[model samples]
Target: MCYSSNGQFLTQIPTWLIVVAGWFVVHHLSQKRDQRKEARERVDQLVTAILSIEERAVRFHQSDSYQGDVARSLLFDIQRIIAKLKRHPFGSFVISPTLLKELRRAVTLKNFDASKFTRQEANSAILSNIADAVDDIEDQLEQEYERIYLSTEWFVVPSQQKNCR
Candidate 1:
């Protein structure tokens, strides 16, 4: 209860109650903002990893020395990344089963023995598959990123609309 000037009665909320309510609202908003930031960071890390794979694939494809060890190492790195992405909480949401299947298919170098195939065949086939897989992953990531970050829109409340009109 509150009394204004001239002892007029005024309905007043307790200051402590108002403060608590404000705190809750602020805390909720802060949590949501933090979640969004973390999600964006995860997306960025995934994108970086994919880009690194692409760069490495391109370099290996162009290099004249088509070492089996290097190819095996690259494949292992890609598989490891894919496994990590699959295990990641955010990654599981963003990466689909179909995409994972496609990645696995692309990463598998069929009959790829460095000694058996000429340099050109190895480069064009195996490296190209890796490149294609990376491209697909990047495209999917971009779509997910846009859906999460760019598609949200705020709408005006009814009272605010009335005021605007």
Candidate 2:
């Protein structure tokens, strides 16, 4: 309780209570911001992985003289991306069985030792399938990203609301 100079009563909230409520809001907002940043980084990584796969796939199909070094380096990067995805929190996006199967087939097509196909027509089919798979996966990732952004809420969680009360 508080009193004015004119002797009127006034309601008072303890300063400590106000500080605690502010703390909870700040802490929760910080946590959410961190999560959003992580999500963006993961999405960027996925985009890079998809683009690299597409570029290598297209080059493999178009090049008559196979560059083994470039192909091998691309394969290395792809494998690293796959491993990273396996460990990433975005398992739902990464673990599409169909997409994995298609990528595996593309890897087979990228096999330098076994894939010295003299004819461009022979490798054309694999290119078509891989291209289609890349497009589908990229589109899927983009859709999921959009969904995440669209569905996000700014309201505090029940736990935070409890702290405020």
Candidate 3:
């Protein structure tokens, strides 16, 4: 009778342990999933900010009324985004050095005096140069996004791989 009770108690202990362990594993995975979701949302916000900057730049360039304040504001917004990304937890891993360089080049318009130029000057080389820089930045951002978020290789764990020996 004593042996039977001990056997039952031992079995119950392992069953309880397995249940607790499974709960912990699930909890850990849920936390990791939530963190990834948050990171993706943050990246999306940064991408949106960059797109807004690009649109405003193109609009300001094409407009007849060139307000220096508006131009400066856009420049400030770009700089702010860059600074924020640099300070982000995943910024160093996700944002390539090339993207940062391109962003810096784009903001070189601090001394841009669009008011001095005639309407014909709107289509000048400076405008094209800014457009090119914006294009390059966009390309770099896409590559980084793909590498960090879209690629399955990035999320794969060696231990979890089916082919692992």
Clashing pairs in 2: none
Predicted candidate 3 versus true structure: per-residue lDDT over 1-165, tens digit per residue: 355576787878888999999999898667656756776777677778877876676666666776678777887887787787765434534555666666546544433476463332556655666667666666665665445545465445322432332
Candidate 2 structure quality by residue, lDDT tens digits, 1-165: 445554342223456678999999898878767766787788788878878777776776566776777667767766776676665445534346677567756755544553554424545767777778777777766765444433455564423332332
> lDDT for every model?
0.61, 0.63, 0.63
C-alpha RMSD by candidate, in order: 7.7, 6.4, 5.5
Off by over 4 Å in 2: 1-11, 14-19, 91-94, 110-116, 119-123, 146-150, 153-165
Give the candidate order by descending TM-score: 3, 2, 1
lDDT of 2 at 50: 77
Worst 10 residues of 1 by lDDT: 156-165
Where does model 3 exceed 4 Å of error?
1-4, 107-111, 114-165
| Candidate whose TM-score is highest | 3
lDDT of residue 51 for candidate 1: 73
Give the winner by TM-score: 2 or 3.
3
